[model samples]
Target: MRRRPPSREELDDYIRTRLALIGIDLSVLPEDDPDAPADQLRVLRSARRVLEQTVPALSDYSLDPQEVPPSMYPAHLPAVRQVAMEEGRPAPAAGGSGRPEEDAP
Candidate 1:
């Protein structure tokens, strides 16, 4: 069975909420470990915002359809294109010559 990918905004919300939950869990620790990295959650939260709002985006994403089997292509392409568009880039070019750029060199 196939599962639909969550939209980018939904993912951002989930990450922020999850990070806050982790911070809460850490707060319950037996001692305030002074060595704990400072503003770790804040940095993560900022990074997530940067991801959604920044024009520069990740290419060669791990879940990229280009990396997947043909069978999964029918399931994943729309979300990939949507994410690319949301990040201010066009959807990946279609019908390439079937070789990775580096391999062509």
Candidate 2:
């Protein structure tokens, strides 16, 4: 016997629980209401726009949509954060001397 994937409602509940853990409560959004406020509509649109722009870049860099961890973001990956800490200072730029020009004197 094979395991079944969670239903959409289950996934939504999981996401909402995670959000609530971090002080977000989406209950204020009017569910399927035709008379929802313009400000609310704009917020939803802008959020979608940001996700549209973000998802492709994240996927291009080897992230999967369903693999999104509740507490994670693109730059917040463990390896990336670790590398920053280990560097202790910023990395040198490519083909550029490791110091600012004119101020090196």
Q: Write the per-residue lDDT of candidate 2 for residues 1-105, one digit (tens) a residue.
A: 232545545645665677689998677886555567634344455555544556434533433222555455553444544575587744222121222322211
User: TM-score per candidate, in order?
Assistant: 0.24, 0.32
Q: List the residue pairs that clash in candidate 1.
A: none
Q: Positional deviation of 41 in candidate 2, in angstroms?
A: 12
How accurate locally is residue 86 in candidate 1, as Cα lDDT from 0 to 100?
A: 88
lDDT of 2: 0.48
**Cα miss at 62, model 2 (Å)?**
5.1
Kindly state the number of residue pairs that clash in model 2.
0
Native-to-model Cα distance after best TM-score fit, residue 9 in candidate 2, in Å: 1.4
